[model samples]
Target: KIKNWLSAPDSSRNMNEAYGKLQDGTCSWFFEGEQFSTWKEEPSFLWVKGKGKFLLVSLSSIIHNVDLAKQDSSLSMAYFFFDGRDSQTELQLHHKLIRSLIWQLSYREDHKVPLPLVNLYKKYGHQQPLDRVLRDRSFRWIALQIEELKKCASKNEIQKKLGKLPRGLDETYQRILKGIDRDYWDDTKIFLQFLAFSKRPLKVDELAEVITVDLGSEEGPAFIEDKQYQDPRIVLTRCSSLFLLLYLLNKTSGIIKLSHFSVKEYLLSPMLTKELFMSDAAFTNWVQLWNIDLNIWDQKRSRDKTDVMKMASALYYASLAGIKPTVELLLTNKAEVNAQGGWWGNALQAASAECHRDIVELLLVNKADVNAQGGDYGNALQAASFHGHRDIVELLLQNKAEVNAQGGYHGNALQAASARGYKYNVELLLINEAAVNAEGGYHGNALQAASAEGHRDIVELLLQNKAEVNAQGGEYGNALQAASFHGHRDIVELLLQNKAEVNAQGGEYQNALQAASAGGHRNIVELLLQNKAEVNAQGGYYGNALQAASTGGHRDIVELLLQNKAEVNAQGGYYGNALKAASHWGHRDIVELLLQNKADVNAQGGEYGNALQAASFHGHRDIVELLLVNKAEVNAQGGEYGNALQAASAEGHMDIMELLQEKDAINEDHKEEFSTE
Candidate 1:
């Protein structure tokens, strides 16, 4: 089945089939003696020797190794493919498009390189076209330009012969140089260069002498310090770190030759990246015949104590060293693959928790628990979801990791994903059929979690996927209250639009309106009001919406509630009137708004004494004056405010006393002294 991309005229885009159909059909520069044929397009792309079905493409000298000599100059990038367009543009844009291709293949640990875009024709721009049509089909030109730049020959000298540069080079190479100058993570070229030297011996031989001739070693640091030593290779060598490795290789030829030999035998070995230096399995096997303990998984431990901590540490160090340690090494005789540890986790737990899909795979292959929960991570899958490790989550799900296992931070992976707004992991879990409404630990269900965190997109996704909008609240995850509290106007709009219970209340906080009022979110209060959220629905520690808003000192919220007909003198909470409550906290705006809304001047709050006294006690002189101007009682005894004089004296408000004097208020009738300091 030939794809459309294979029919494209762009050589870089249609390389595979086009090159495959070539008369010679030989890329001696790459797979010297390889042949290609066909097989049934089933479920795999496993290329076999002498089979015309499987074919590979070389991505050509990705980096210039003329400078970085310490590290073996890795030349040549390779991958397999079935499409012809991948071959077409691939040929033309092969050199310059290296940066774009590397990014398209984000080679994180577990999700191995997409060798198909290189080798497999599966997702090649074979059929459905995308917006990005790669232009700078001149990676080789960029390489040339970089070489010319290294010469430091002045512009006229440099531009003496070569024609105009490609547009992409003009715009991008300078930028890439700027980044390399700043030490960014653009090492694919360097990495590919390293791969090149390590694989092809002839290529290695061609570059070795030029790169390894370190004249700087003789003059030490000052040798290359000469104005004559100003080579662009010097800069690239310093940046790419090839010079150091080459220097080391030259300094210690024995180690280099041995490691190089090992590379020849196992160029693609994951073990090489790790400390598991089994030079060769055959060689090691022969030595082991002598009863050698080739156990790389050695660690001191208590007999019954599985050192998950130590195992994690080893795995961590291995990854940093580009090592791929397996569960076989992790779970020796009785290392206990499922052993639990402290807060962090057990073996399976830690892998899942850290979203270390590779480690998790090794453990699961060796029988690590997937559903088992009792560590920092709720479960293996849950841990992956928490960290937004989508690939790891997919791996776990493929291996039958549970979708709704609970008992971690928010309970399950779904809720965890929702809490973090991990769109990819959330989608992965959902695609794997994660329960949307299933409660996770104490955080209710996925809907509640996404709503609480104001993750509108996730909430909309959940709602679209049919999560019950009113799935009863959890211990602390009250979806409606949470939306109201954070003033998440859009989330509130979404929930209400989706028929979420406006007056819903039954968790740590009660009712949407009260929560909104307490949170001082005027817009959310308005949305709830629009949705018919009860003006008096009460629950949380603060009681009704009026009291909640008044106590919260939310002047705007108070006015909106009043405009929505919230009772001003409504006696609620330990403090009675909203006016007295706001006044007690010196919230002058809320106090004045309440007064303007016709709140009673003498509305004696059970704990607040009266508006004037409450204002005086909190040293809200502005509030005291507003109340007095509104004809509030001058003296109100008992409760937190004590008496008017006592409250004013406590706050040291001489102006309040003078205001009382100006009002011809009698201090002889009532008197009380109080001291806090």
Candidate 2:
């Protein structure tokens, strides 16, 4: 049936659709090329020809028949396909393969399923439906099997049973390792070491670039530009039979990862490292390789070459990795103790950021620069504070690492800790006399960062420490505006209680009331209003609280602002006035409310000229008609498309244009407006 369907002229066999069907049990056959001939020996399995491929089916009947042939056998057969396109699918396939083996082992010709196998089935089977299990891509099946194995009478019995299993990942990996020639063994070992130990996944090109560079050369590291850019494939070729066991090809990104995370776990095992002749020195070398400068000469002539070279060393990576032995080995070999390189800038900073207390202490003991000012967090103090590594922060402080160093992502240690809501770290910094109102980071100051993140305790602490509540600089304007925008009612209340100026205007949303209205925080808007917030204040992103509320389609907030006596025809925001904002967003109800509240339908300003022009431009014919019915000047010329009729015509809204034309809205001036273009 499948073959005939495939051969049909109208056959629409999408690979993804077929795969989905097979997974859902709606399809039992999978298409393959002529290569499927190898499985023809299996009597239970059938292959049928398709247009240019064959459909292979191994259903329940085939499985039952196969079990009958091996009713009394102790050994089970399992087959796995590694070409799965995704991790979830791959894991599900693994479960299916394992289940099949267990199913075969459970069968007996003379009796019911064996007690152990039956118990195993009862424990793991039918608990989670197959569809739900696959959807979640759970590891429950694997965990159940491991638990069953633990119930074996003895370790020897468990080993004996496991010995009968098919060649698994570990065995396959060992086999590949054994097959590699001695000539390429060292290079392969080093390459695998990098994959096994590196903190982040190395890109294929990056791995290739690093491996081809000679790190030991005196003329600094030389980048072999002519080397194969597609080095992952080359590495696989060099490892030969072992490639599949070691690496998993991510088809979407073309980046190769370890076949499974377990592969790295196996490679990192002490016994495997010993067998492969890998040592701390080799690990240090791998770290050194990551830092080698390809453009060494160009960098040397630059202003800060020493700092750059130091930044690109093994000590920084080893410190980042938190590998004490490798770090000690590198330090012993006279690796730059305070080498500045990588993202964190220096070894101390890297160690500090990752909360590697031991390494941080080691670098400090080696007389590493305590106040280095370069990396993402600026110095060790800020790095530790940013990551909430209290012990490391204390250590850096004890070593007199400058607490007020101004640079990196959050500007200073105090702001970094406060921004991340690290109460203890913030207190420690404050105790050490760090500036509470330091102004120069991403969030302007600690108070604003704390307020923006909705950290009430941090905000209170900063306020208590005399931090400026109205410090206007960061992304969100002021503490009150930031808190209001993010819907942090308690924080907003606290700021207000701390004397945050209710009418202060400056940031992205201009004022607290507008920010609150824009974010749809009705309660905050109400709170700001109660605090005597200026409802008609204009400036900032959305102009006024009513306009901001209207732009966001917050009908209740808009109504509240209107009740507070907000200007109905206020003109400043991106959408001109509240009426235009409501019309542009197609909020007919809000438009009705605004129009009933005496909003000017012909108010001309902002991105769209008037409410009619905004409504017509956006293809909101009902809104355009409503505006016109409400006495909007249709012939009014302004905004991007000149007038309402021209705006409708420009957007190809013929129905709206016809309505406008029927009203005689398009005048000679409107015609001239389009003629010039």
Candidate 3:
């Protein structure tokens, strides 16, 4: 691919055409310019250096020992002339190197030279004398032309050449402003600013959703009509030149990015941004334009109103972007410091969540609400804790933010920090007197949260800090259950050593043993069993430990449980019995093992009527045959699809149906003879 690109005609074209294609959004802006000599015979290592607008390609070793003696004289003279006269920047050094190679290729006639060089020699050898070319004024003029081509190739220079150079992102954006119809200018400008300043690339649908939100209304942004959610290309049509869709290898998934990295640089440039707010009037106009109104409106009246206020203001975007100056400018213009809307809820939360310490400090100084609630993380502290922003957490804490505030994904700041395994932050929260037993979040409390994530150190810390080890609340019921379910044997052992009740029931999986069995954690299951966990103790998603292991097709666990005297025909839980559960999932080996252990083949319970029906329904012919040979009642009726024959027939299994019918007929013959006797 590199060789084909280097040899292509496009490589020889001037930068003007290349930059034109890039700006017009007709070509990708990833052009490569060779910076190192390719004429060397040794293995060449290509090094890529990204300069202002173009990628400079160079070689690690410019010349092999064989080529050096032949090509050294001419190449050295060119380099000496360019190097001694001027102190060149890296880009300029690359330019000089490329120009010297062009000169060498233009005049050299040696057949031993590389093919690309040979081709160039064939084209330009007759035009100039090889040795005297550097001394000739006309050859110097050709050098000047190549320099001009380099300038044209630069994205920045291309913009300047086309008379489209804006002082910064705002100026370039103003061009987009001019092109948009006045009706869309307000909403469109807001959307463009988000595209320019967001921390991460926005999906096409996300952009659409944000723009249509009326930030001015207090009741929250109204959902735009479905018709307004048009294709992404349509949304970006007027300013298509400024954006490009970066398609993934799948071609279906893509995110929007600026056409060139320079575009982002221009937007972020301090000089250009300063020009945007040179006057109070200009600043106020920008503020008003960017401000989202948070006033509530009558639903009936709002439906007819096309120009709803935006949900996020300029302050929100500035905070999200970490543009300190823009944030200061918005604040000075009285952009609401406590505005409660948008994805982050407010500017302070956005800054805190993003870990922009300077911005967070600035917002705090501006008296932004440190305890403001309502967003994904519920408040700034929780957001900071969730993302492990220790500095931000410290700052918020110093500002008298509530230490025990209850809200957000993890319920509170401590739980959030603990869940994510932020040990230092968890320590900080604990030092600040964060509630040790705070409940009500994703993981019921800090201990369970730590246990669920397998953070042994955090679990130890919580336990040492007097956390309720056997505290019965959370997604997994308690810390021990949470650890066992996730196969965290070490944490489970720790919880157990801390005196967590081994038989403690109440979670998606009833107890520690059942949870371990369901998760296929044989070691944890064994440990729980060793610790005297009730093997037949029922009550969870699966009723018993043996059934749980059977449901998960853990044949070893099943055999181990049976060896420990687990009831083979025990009933209860999702599949009703161990044999039924094993048969349902078509684990032939487990089914045979259970049958050998004298599991009642005619055990009539569970989602399927019996073990025979469970096997037949799932098309496990061998298990069905095994069960039939063991005298499982062929006509046993009871369960979801009626009987074994009906179950097989319902699932379109003809062979199982034939076997069941043959067995039923034989049973009928036996019954008839007994009745006659």
Candidate number achieving the greatest TM-score relative to the actual structure: 2
TM-score of each: 0.49, 0.67, 0.62
Candidate 3 or 2, higher TM-score: 2
TM-score of candidate 1 on Cα atoms, chains taken together = 0.49
Q: Which regions of candidate 2 are displaced past 4 Å? A: 1-165, 174-190, 215-254, 266-281, 291-311, 633-636, 643-677
Which stretches in model 1 have alpha-carbon errors above 4 Å?
Answer: 1-330, 475-478, 604-613, 629-635, 640-677
User: Which candidate, 2 or 3, would have the higher lDDT against the true structure?
Assistant: 2
Query: What overall lDDT, based on C-alpha atoms, would model 2 receive against the true structure?
Result: 0.69
Clashes of each: 55, 3, 13
Clashes of 3: 13
For model 2, how many clashes?
Answer: 3
> In what order do the candidates fall by TM-score, top score first?
2, 3, 1
| lDDT by residue for model 3 (646-676), tens | 6786677877777776776223334442221
Q: Against the correct fold, how does model 3 do in TM-score?
A: 0.62
Q: Relative to the true structure, how large is the alpha-carbon lDDT of every model?
A: 0.54, 0.69, 0.68
Report the C-alpha lDDT of model 2 over 1-677, residue by residue, as the tens digit. 22121121111112212321232222222211112212422335555343211121233212211322222246454333223222223222455445544554443423476677656556754455578544442243343335446768998989985775424445545655777888877667756776666555554544544555666677767644344334345666555432423333354224445555555655866769776646665565676675554374363232222222333577887787788988887788677787666777889898887788998888888889989888777888988897688998888888887889898878899988987788999999999999888887767889988987668888888888999988888767788887888678899899888899999988878889998887777888889989999889999877888998887677899899999999999888777789988887677889999989998888889766888888887778888889889988878988887788887777777788878776777568546544323
Q: Give me candidate 2's TM-score against the actual structure.
A: 0.67
